[model samples]
Target: MDASVIVAGAGPAGLMLAAELRIAGADVIVVERLPERTGESRGLGFTARTMEVFDQRGLLPRFGEVETSNVGHFGGLPVDFGVLEGAHQAAKTIPQSVTETILEQWAAELGADIRREHELLSLREDGEGVEIEVSTPEGRRTLRASYLVGCDGGRSTVRKAAGFDFPGTAATMEMYLADLRGVELEPRMIGETVPGGMVMVGPLPGGITRIIVCERGNPPQRRTEPPAFQEVADAWKRLTGIDISHAEPVWVSAFGDATRQVTEYRRGRVLLAGDAAHIHLPAGGQGMNTSIQDSVNLGWKLGAVVRGTAPETLLDTYHGERHPVGRRLLMNTRAQGLLFLSGEEMQPLREVFSELIRYEEVSRHLAAMVSGLEIHYDVGSGTHPLLGLRMPRLELSADGRRTSSTELLHRGRGVLLDLEDNAVLRRRAAGWTDRIEVVTAAPAGAAPGGPLEGTAAVLVRPDGHVAWAAPGSHHDLPTALERWFGPAR
Candidate 1:
């Protein structure tokens, strides 16, 4: 095989997956049609969960003084994202272009082969691997790999070529987004509705501002090129009575509320990630965040399979896990569109929502949903609270040394943390030492009676989710190891 995996597109998801695969000791190649990075950014920042994902790999310092906020909105309604304290706040200022550049650099530094100006033309999958044809700067060439993943956006060629069923709602309205340099506007971080429609304006770095306009009675339309700046300015005036045609346009584009998701994330040897697996209204800035999380989840699993450390069936978990998350993403974004973009008739629903959000429990629930902290997978049968949930951040002291749970995951290896340091438990896990890391430590400071209160030993996946917890075990350590890491070496 030319490489263990071939990743299509150089967007955030593709770059992130390539970096992860490299960390897990897999040969990866990333192909992108664009000759260079597009400075335009559709997503302004990432969610808190995505922040943790980056922090797991020690990639945050590279961004240099990230600006974050605990204050956010849910469908134009004010909501505080600080319900969970001591967690990373939502990054609010970094542009998507900067995110892509960082991930591309990270992936390249890890020895991932990235090919620019190389476009995937076609792909055919057999029982063993996938063969792909690409149009490159040199000429057309065929490349073979054990697996292929498409991160090429909503209109994914890999999803189409592989015959995956994309079933969901279609676009109904078109909205304009533009970044300007010569205009100074009031900050509408969420959005505001007028008699006609809604408009949003927020300041950015480098004396620039971003604006979004949704005009009433405008239907979604297809165009070969992006809408002109004047069109966006006109829509702004119609919605907010603001005619700032003098604002020098930096980037202009249009989008829709159409939502869609594939029935499955994997098909034989071909797989999908990012917008290829799911697309929805960019509500709560969840599109890019969800896409990045998807790549992180799939990266380690794919790497294990390619390196012959795990069974091929492990790849099936990617679909079983992320498909449901994608479905919920579509559901929540469609609900938000109704609340944020609908006509006056939605005022009553908005009022009801506003009233509901006043309760502390309601606020916390909504905040977790938008921040991606409430995700719980069904890893297996166990009553432990930490089971299938993200391993909460905790301080530990091992052999008089200090460390945190997040720091241990920087190397992209499964962690079997033994709080009691049982000799029998360590002996049982010795066979999988090559694939998993064993750490013996006790909680530091006043450890609360939370998920790890009574746990004696905990097993965490490379993606940061707790796969197994000890206290009461039905399957035992050996069984959990086999279920996640594969048969003992």
Candidate 2:
């Protein structure tokens, strides 16, 4: 158990995978190029699914309890999460630095060895495992692990060395972003559209506020020269018609989002997640959220495989489940880019959708799209309603216990759900002891004395997702166990 998994890159994806692996009792090591955590915030927000994952892990509260969330719509207008059918429907505004910090600290608490200023130079993989080479201050050193994860982001050395093809269209527009201090921009009322351009502003924890501006033109998509800082502010002034002569500029950079995705996410013992696996525009702020979600999807499965609780075929599902998700993110971001960056010709279309967002159903749909809540896997069949859906928060009142699905997951074990405890189903689920937790709920959506007809013995995964379910004990529970949890090891 020297190195069960070696995670490259200490960004959100790597740190999250390290945290999950450590929690699953795996000897994990994290490698990053940065010497210390960057105080500058990267991405601007987190979706509901991301928050649910954090909440389920009991780490959300440790994020300093910042409750600044936008329950409205993206671009502009209003939306509703209650009407959405997916796992997470809301988007929470939190910076990348905060998320990475929380995950880094949590992984450290779980005793994950995090190496900084050390870049992976090479990796050799065979049927046995992976042999990784890294360049450190002292010199070069090699480490062996059962598996290696490349969360190293785009331009991933791991993906390149593995000879994976990242094929897709890069962003058509080049954008400039800067963090401003002493600015008069309204943080909450950010992301505005003007006649000639679009401005996205986000006020961070401190007085620093983020400003993103993109011109609607056919300018060269790539920037080789250092961006003119004054021009950026001037563009903001011209777009928003606001004077910010007194604002102090902090950090500035220019980047274009290339909507590229690798055809294969895994090759033998090496795995890719986040930007390493897929690249898309940050127009909707989906990059960080998507990457963290990718790690969440892969982490538990990898752990299951390492523990001999899952078949080798289980690893293949990582690509099957996530590749489509990456494609969807790219498509959605591209559509958003067209709407936000289009010229006068597209204004009518944007106006139509903008008006349509007023409807709860439409708003919820877009919210689900922007927040990463609309994902539902065709895992098996339409037999059970809870299968492949997120384990929703429910109330409990058994043994004077009152809690939610989030609280029950703190122990980090799967739960066997007996909603209302229907007699036939209860008798059928009597044998699933150690592998599945049994929780009887009442029909009133309470703890006990409820009917479990439509849903029976819902099995939640280690990552708070429904893995397997039986509407009745009539279905062979033993087979389901063998297929999902690998025959009790």
Candidate 3:
């Protein structure tokens, strides 16, 4: 086999998956159609949960001076995220190009083979494995792998070739996005509605301003060529009475509110993640964040399977877990589209939503939804309140040294955190020590009623979700271990 896994596209999801497979000691190859990085960024920031995910891998420092914000919005209505517990504000200004660069470098440092100018032409998945045909700069070639993953954006060649069902509502409206210089305008960070449509203008680094123009009554069009800058400037003038024709355009593109998701994330040896699995309106800046997370959730499980450390059934969990999240993603983005993009007909709904958002419960729920903190998988039947949830950040004292739950996960290994030093619990999980790390720790500087107050111990999956907890839980530790980390050695 050319590699244990072949990942199509070198965007954030594909590069992240490659790094994850390498972390699990599996050979991975990443193929990208682009010969070089575009340096143009459509996604401007990431959700709070993505920040924590990057922290778990010791990748925060790579970005160099990140700006986080406690303030955010849902459908252009203000909703503070500070109300949620353990929520670090979302990263405000990191560009998608920078994110891709970081992931590509990290994956390369981890020994992932990344090939540029390699376009996937065809793929065939049989009973044994998947074979792919690719067109390189020199010529066409065939590559084999145990599995193939598509991260090639909304129009996925792998998803199409593998016959994955992508069903959803088509685009009803289209908008223009441009990043350019030589123009200065009042900041419309949360977007502003005008007579005929809406417009948003925000400043980026290097004197460039990002503008989004959404002219109402403009139908969605399937165009092979990008919209000209003059068209965008004309729309801006018609909508908001602003003339941006003098601005020098750096990058220009168009998008639509076309919502869709794959019926299945995997079909035999071929799988999907990121935009390949889901696509929706770029509301609340959740598209790229969700795509990045899809890779994280699938990476460890696929790595385990390829390394022969876990059963193939574990792979099924990727679909079982993420497909629902993708469904929710589509739902939320569609709701936001109605709230933010529709005409005056949606004003009442927006008013009701705004009033409801004033309530702390409503604010917390919406904050968690957009920030991705509300994601909880059905790991098992347990009422520990922490089960199937991403493990909260905690300060721990281990061997007279201070560490954090996030630090323990830097190695990308499952963690059995024994908070009370239970010998029985430690012994119960000893058989899986080779695959899981056992860290005896206790709360350090924790308040009386903190999130982990009643927890005696917790088994955290490699992806940072709680697999099992000891307090007020009936599932045995050994059973939980066997279910997640594979059978005991």
- lDDT tens readout by residue for model 1, 13-104: 99999999999899998999999998889988989999999988999999999999998888889887888666789998899999999999
Error of 1 at 196 (Å): 1.3
Q: CA lDDT of each candidate?
A: 0.90, 0.74, 0.90
lDDT of 3 by residue, 286-393 (tens): 988988899999999998888887898898999999999999999998888777777888899989998999999999999999999999998888789889999988
Indicate the worst ten consecutive residues by lDDT in candidate 2.
443-452
How accurate locally is residue 174 in candidate 2, as Cα lDDT from 0 to 100?
69
lDDT of 3 at 365: 97
Clashes of 2: 7
Q: Model 1, 319: alpha-carbon shift in Å?
A: 0.6
Q: How does model 3 score by TM-score?
A: 0.98
- Between candidates 2 and 3, which one is better according to TM-score? 3
- Give the CA lDDT, 0 to 100, for residue 23 in model 3: 93
Candidate 2, position 206, lDDT: 73
lDDT of 1 at 429: 97
Backbone clashes, candidate 1: 0
